[model samples]
Target: MSENNHAYTLSDGTSILDLPKVSLHDHLDGGLRPATIIELGSEIGLELPASDADALGAWFAEKSNSGSLVEYLKTFDLTTAVMQTSAGLERVAREFVQDLGADGVVYGEIRWAPEQHLGSGLSLDQTVEAVQSGIEQGIADVRAAGRPIRVGQLVTAMRHNDRGLEIAELAVRHRDNGVVGFDIAGPEAGFLPSKHRAAFDYLATEFFPATVHAGEADGLDSIRSALLDGRALRLGHGVRIAEDIVIERQDDENTYVTLGTLAQWVKDREIALETSPTSNLQTGAIAAWGDELIDHPFDLLYQLGFRVTVNTDNRLMSGTTLTRELSILADAFAYDRTDLEVFQLNAAASAFLPLEEREELADIISAGFEGS
Candidate 1:
């Protein structure tokens, strides 16, 4: 019913790569090509864990499966190391857009912390410019190849660091450029979003949008901080929000459910959950539920009418594309093309674009799916 020979396909024989998709939580530093890393690492005299591109890719995939968020995040050091220079950042950004296009992404928001890439003496603004330049080039590349694709930047601040307010200002300053949103990414357990309340408040005043990383390495209280203090429009890897739901009982054909106040608020507001299955499994975000993809609360949330969007949090580390993510979820949850279309529609609506643009995206997705 399905094939994975060269391209990903669904049970109905629809090529997943031909479907229009929108990505919400993709990380810029975490999606680099393995060959690019080797070349860039060589320029800076950095020793790689593997010599060849395929093995280096395997190395990243192997290292990221450690089942600890902290341990899984250590892989970013190698990626960020090569992304310090302007040229390096530009090239990576350019290629990232191309890769997403190839994976059938019509629109995507690439998030990264500029602070982490400042080691090469590039100012925060310079890093943003370099990335924007590459994104534009990549857009052109995709268009030239007869594919429609667009990407925006989500400038992120390190939650464990002290430059939250500064990073927020940088994100707002470039709002007209490639930047579309702001975020706080890093260890999520102790570094609550409230630690950057001032930054969130500034963003609130300027009316800049933000999506906080919460409910992944932390629990309900952290998600609460992200909503109450950070005013996050979306929750990054918010699979743990499932903890707030209490399944009272399940009959032969129906299951009774009770949602806590936090879960109710998220559902009512339609705040998106950027759920990355492989990344969640690797980071132990869904460990309490189960270790496999089926154990992910993704189905529970989606079935409960929560706004859940599939994402590739880190393509390289997870060794996954968006098509692969959707395909695996389909296999695990027995979802058909309609279900897949809904997921893409949810993502299109949740994108940081304006209402009209989001509607346009939804139209595009609907048309693509209808055609398929």
Candidate 2:
């Protein structure tokens, strides 16, 4: 069961929440518990649109489902406001891990932009330390509860901002700490990864990894820049890449398809697509395909071997858990345990970990699924 008790049992009565999973594209600030937000906001004398946790959660969900990426982002103003202090940031991070653990995530990468949390007096490094402290405490809490879990930070740089180089340096500086990788997130259409060339170059020189937000709020041109300019190893919410694929003809037995040049490169390289299904529908990322999850190109990408990984980009805003994400996909596609296991394995392969560790994670997942 998830933290919300969203029990998703498979056909064989195997609970999805009991399966060891890997989360590669969750956001730290986006996963805050609604009760925590109310408490933190009260402590900071912040005005919340909703006075109660349930109401606040519903409010976020309602706002995020507005079918516009711009409107979907307005809810973050409140979340970021409450996280301006070190204590708030640490507490949020700790609870975020607890929630992930409860949802059966063996490993997760929590991404957030340090620049957004600096509204208070803390410096850049201070924010990183605060989040790391919370992650350690959360890991301890999960272990104390007898569930093994591991988590790392992916420091993000808002694409609309000019702090890409500075945030990149901050991420590299804290690589030995809890920070594991780098990313650029935020309104994706107007702000191409090319604008952050200097930062990408710096990270490349340092041999650091990155996952850029593309193919969600933007098109193939944006994805091209993410690969060539940002040098991203993975793409965040890369559902739009389906736009580049052309189905020449479909018959009862075979569906002939042709991949565009850029799509072919991404597929050939096995670059992971960090796809968030519900969020994609809400943000209209897959409107070009259809308005429903069944219409999503996830199955198309998976059947064609695109290294697609499932993720919950924003839990609170979407009112979802990783468990729920998998459950919905399972329900939509009539997926069996084998299909679910494949998604988890794909995520394990794409995690920001060493080759040996990723293999170890894969072994854990395989073992867990077998027992399930």
- The number of clashing residue pairs in model 1 is 0
The sequence of per-residue lDDT tens digits that candidate 1 reaches over residues 11-108 is 89988878999999999999999999999999999999898998999999999999999999999999999999899999999999999998889999
Residue 285 shift from truth in candidate 1, angstroms: 0.2
How large is the C-alpha RMSD of every model relative to the true structure? Answer: 1.9, 1.3
Query: How does candidate 1 score on lDDT?
Result: 0.94
Q: Rate the local accuracy (lDDT) of all candidates.
A: 0.94, 0.92
The window of 10 residues in a row where model 1 has the poorest summed lDDT is: 1-10
lDDT of 2 by residue, 169-256 (tens): 9999999998899999999989999999999999999999999999999999999999999999999989899999999999998878
Model 2 alpha-carbon drift over 4 Å, by segment: 1-6
The estimated TM-scores of all candidates read 0.98, 0.98
